[model samples]
Target: MKKIFLLAALIGFSPIFSQERDQIRERDEISPDNSWLKVGITGGVPVGDANNASSFALGADIRGQYLFNPNIAIGIASGYTNYFGKDGFDDFGVIPAAGFFRYYFTPSGLFLGTDIGYGFVTNVENNDGGLYVNPQIGYHNRDWNIYAYYQNTFLETDMDIQNVGVGVTYNIRFN
Candidate 1:
């Protein structure tokens, strides 16, 4: 019985120690890379007055970026968020185009990011367009990302609307 157990352990250990270093490196090179485009779909709950007037918010976004040494990225972003109506007010929606920026902790998956730009609020009454900004914190990997953020619409001389929510992003890489 002792001999059989020793033989089994040696068989398992041998395969690991016997692997060529070059073969491991070659296998790593064959694996898919994380670069290029990231597309995201998000849902948010309205906060403050925005929530009283609307039920929730939903949006979609796209970004193109270059990884500058694996810790930072910058790109452009645009999306539409629909704020559903509740009882008193009508549905509100905005189309925002912005510049995207992100910084990740080196060798870790945590990140902080932001988007800022002009947003046109087309479906609301008695107000013009506004400035759009989103600040977010998230965990990300090569396959997927998850984040929580505050999205704000600041209409000049008028009320500011806030949407707070979480979102998921899918990553697509190109070689």
Candidate 2:
């Protein structure tokens, strides 16, 4: 009777230990990766010293970033801005090109970004370029994005320009 009971217990537990589905999941269960080009439309008013000589501004930016990991990305960013004329200065344009990075903090696409490089200021007659820095925060998604950012340009002989703005971006994939 003891030998029969031992054999019954072994047979009952053998299938449970040998099951493959309990140790592994299906391969196609994860979400697709996000890495692509970004085109944005932005508009906002100049702030601080920039507002002293210029009116509101409108701008656009382009970026190509690679999602190196799920939460981080690095790439190139460039922008074009036009500030309205005011009493102290004529209308001017701003162009900045920089190496940028974005860091996502949540699973739902909240992120912070920063960029540093050179910026160009122009009124078609006299042009000057200098150091640039940009910082941003918003919700970044694979399909769409919305952000608020600040632009700071350090000029060689003129006062630094500071503009604050909000933007919307769309993500596109070729394949």
| Local distance difference test, each candidate | 0.81, 0.80
Candidate 2 — worst ten consecutive residues by lDDT sum? 23-32
All candidates: CA RMSD in angstroms? 12.9, 8.9
> Over the full model, what C-alpha lDDT does candidate 2 score relative to the true structure?
0.80
Over 96-158, each residue of candidate 1 has an lDDT whose tens digit, in order, gives 888888998854589999999887886777777789999999998777789999999897756
Q: What is the lDDT of residue 14 in candidate 1?
A: 82
Clash count per candidate: 0, 0
**Cα TM-score per model:** 0.75, 0.76
Q: What's the true lDDT of residue 9 in model 1?
A: 99
Where in model 2 is the C-alpha error above 4 Å? 1-34, 124-127
Best of the candidates, lDDT:
1
Error of 2 at 101 (Å): 0.6
lDDT (Cα, tens digit) per residue for candidate 2, span 39-142: 88888889877798788988888887777667887879887988887996888878988999989886567999988888888783443878989899999766
Model 1 clashing residue pairs (backbone): none
